[model samples]
Target: MNTLFMHCRPGFEGEVCSEISDHAARLNVAGYAKAKPQSACAEFICHEPEGPQRLMRELRFAELIFPRQWARGEFVPLPESDRIGVLLEHLSNLPTCSSVWLEVLDTNDGKELSTFCRKFEVPLRKALIKAGKLQEDGNGPRLLLTFKSGREVFVGLADADNSAMWPMGIPRLKFPREAPSRSTLKLEEAWHHFIPRDQWDARLNGDMTGVDLGAAPGGWTYQLVRRGMLVTAIDNGPMAESLMDTGLVQHLMADGFTFKPKQTVDWMVCDIVEKPARNAALLETWLGEGLCREAVVNLKLPMKQRYAEVRRLLDRIADGFKARGVKVSIGCKQLYHDREEVTCHLRRLDMKPRPSH
Candidate 1:
């Protein structure tokens, strides 16, 4: 496993890379993490011969992208003067591995693009015709377009330079100036890595429910409700009237930590203004008590070792679940909507939780 193509959540390159580096150190895998400028994909290229196969076997990917395992492959072109076969031979020994995706981060003249397409069997003329990126002369793939969603588009390779990796359109320190709606929710644009509606809808089921702590403005709640499950909104403040109007949510005017539902819900979600450890503890408590089936919460982080803090919280949460005989899945990402906090999604042991009065 010389090179593994890791797809991190959009805008979470640093967190994913740091976690991988830490895992490598602990497991003694010889590798370093590098960001791919084109998107949230990170390249985990191993220097040691056996590192790829070993790491992939032991790899426990984050839960957000769970069930969707990391695809194992390597970069074909390198250093502007390397042979693709030389690199491929070095990568060949990994078990049950096949195929490589040409990860072109940048392109110069038409020659380079054409060469890459030829090497990858990308069918330049056909792809261009299908994508409408070429002329009758078959010489252009130029389209300077901006997608708020995370779709994969073939821009003129030249146009890829200086692009933001996460593609959030642009970073904003504040919420939107206008009110949000289904139109504003933009599921396609927001979670572009996910498959389209059919698969996405299948992911949603009545078996799962959620709580939205500090769910005032209601953007997060909106996402949950659209899934057709009830959400308990815990906050002293009020939610957007629009969310309350949905009838899929229950507004509870109490502190999130103290407000236990009449029955354990399937999920607990929070975005409260609190320290990371404090939020982590709340998550642990709910998870440990079998109070919920899963959770998607946010922890507001301070400057200085934000990465280290994430490491600490991940350990704390994982340890807590293990002690409780819970098999859990967890993921964290600095979402496009996240400013100084990271979003976490955790699913507790799939076994039914203990009955609550």
Candidate 2:
């Protein structure tokens, strides 16, 4: 595998390319990136003979802001009649895979190929099993087969622990019918992405306290309340009657940025539509001042220099906490449910603020 492929949100290829280019340079590997904006895909053409393996080993998928899913593999143009045979040849080149995911780009043409991919999967799985390329015992890497079209595909592999939890980094979580709005999915996705699943129940215990800044209509608040948290919903606008009816939420008519909690809470969640820098500072303040143990906030992005802007804001937050002698865990992700925004999660490890970067 000589070329690296990544799947990002449409219109974000430039940011994706910039991120990979910087990352590759940091790894002391040279590569050139090419991307078609809004195509939802990008390619990193590596100059080194062994760069792909090293890149895969060095870069942790969770830390990448732009790419939803990525793979390092060569493109194989399948001949019409011998498509299966050609794919088998590629599979033989890779280590045995525990499972296979036949994916396509998030584009109109990609949607059109889904039916064909579904049909192709069954026979391909059988062939792989017969050829000793697929393992049923979950001891091998997972194969990622991203189809650019019916005639072309990128064959790649990723370790389960270091890769996205879902195929193409898109989680298939259904919107709860009882939830107030579809925006609820964004918060749910953020928790899944930033927090390990095994710690969820323990982390979000019953009667945990949380404050939802800009909590009008209660999308994020709904998620916290569902976890049995008592919520202080701050917003100038009215909250949903359904949410208020639950009695778990206290709708405070106040501004998110100006309001400060009278007491420390377990979590502070914000979905305020504001500039990324302001939101980033808000998160830094909350963690720095010992106001909350954990926080999840949304940073709506700008049209240009999106990736650079995100990196700057994140750095400021880290530097501010370091200056304040704080120990914290921070994570950022662009979720499937988010539009023009990225979600950030911060957890303060020190009960009382102490300096440690």
Candidate 3:
């Protein structure tokens, strides 16, 4: 009950630990994180018995950039002969779970356990239901059983509204065959992660216009084009011929960092290869100057202090917007399709005039 378990990219365990430590300290929940490099998971053990419970109530999972999914619980050993029996015995103490997710780490060893988890799920689910510990109440908490091995698993609970919708926080997306490059998934995932589905028709409608910096081959531009938006593709390199055939694109050869549009557009997206701080600055300039109403950008991370750098860059952007007397909503995440980088979504809100000084 005093531990929080988190799932992340295989090599990003350190980043998760750093982020959790910072967040926990901010909430005055004295705790320490334990993680192994490349383990794909981390745990924060609270000094006080009730610390994790308080964190689960106050911490917003979507605000955490590194951890894909999180749960509050402790590990329990199971006898190989009666794994389900042991789990049922322990689950008797928990509230009725709405559903159960049997998860594994995203690693080679984790992959090897997938078949076992699948086979174990059917029977375990039935057992839980028969024992009256599982129900279909939509408001009930989700049971998270993360299997570390055949003999050990982490039993935990996650609030559906506060946690990722997908198991292990990994969305299952198949690459569209018509897409020019696999990179298209990055933008797609960003939209899913940042924008609510109900608001898409209003915010990402067909009547909108967009600009894609470094739009070579149109990997990112493809998303906008398919959604029926007119796009200005800026890149010195060539764009995909298929995207050009759409008759909705205006391709330009120019420097993404220096190019300025004649008029503000509805959206601006950048996936340029550049330093993290530099990319953050570019996004700030766009939103601050009223260049675009909304933006999606990827910041390539450095090898060290990745979490610290992300926070600094985001804070800088927020401070810049405040100085300019503009209101904006910012969201950042290390998307499933992203590697060594994080995706950011910035949306300009209605301007609130500053009071007389």
Q: Pick the candidate with the highest lDDT.
A: 3
Question: Model 2 scores what on Cα lDDT?
Answer: 0.88
Which stretches in model 3 have alpha-carbon errors above 4 Å?
351-357
Instruction: Report how far residue 82 has shifted in candidate 2, in Å.
Output: 3.1
Over the stretch 100-142, how does candidate 1's per-residue lDDT look in tens digits? 1233222133224435544533443344345333344433212
How does each model score on lDDT?
A: 0.55, 0.88, 0.91
Tens digits of per-residue lDDT for model 3, 1-357: 889999999899999999999989899999899999889999999999788888889888998899999999989998969888888889878899999999999989999998999999999989988998889765689999999998899999999889887999999988988888999999989999999889787778778889999999999999999889999999999999999999999999999999989988889999999998889999999999988989999999999999999999999999999999999999999988899999999998974322221
Give the Å error, residue 171, model 3.
0.7
The runs of at least 3 residues in candidate 2 whose Cα sits more than 4 Å from the true structure, single-residue gaps closed, are 352-357
Query: RMSD of each candidate?
Result: 10.1, 3.0, 3.6
Candidate 1 global lDDT: 0.55
TM-score of model 3 vs. true structure: 0.97
Write the candidate numbers in order of decreasing lDDT: 3, 2, 1
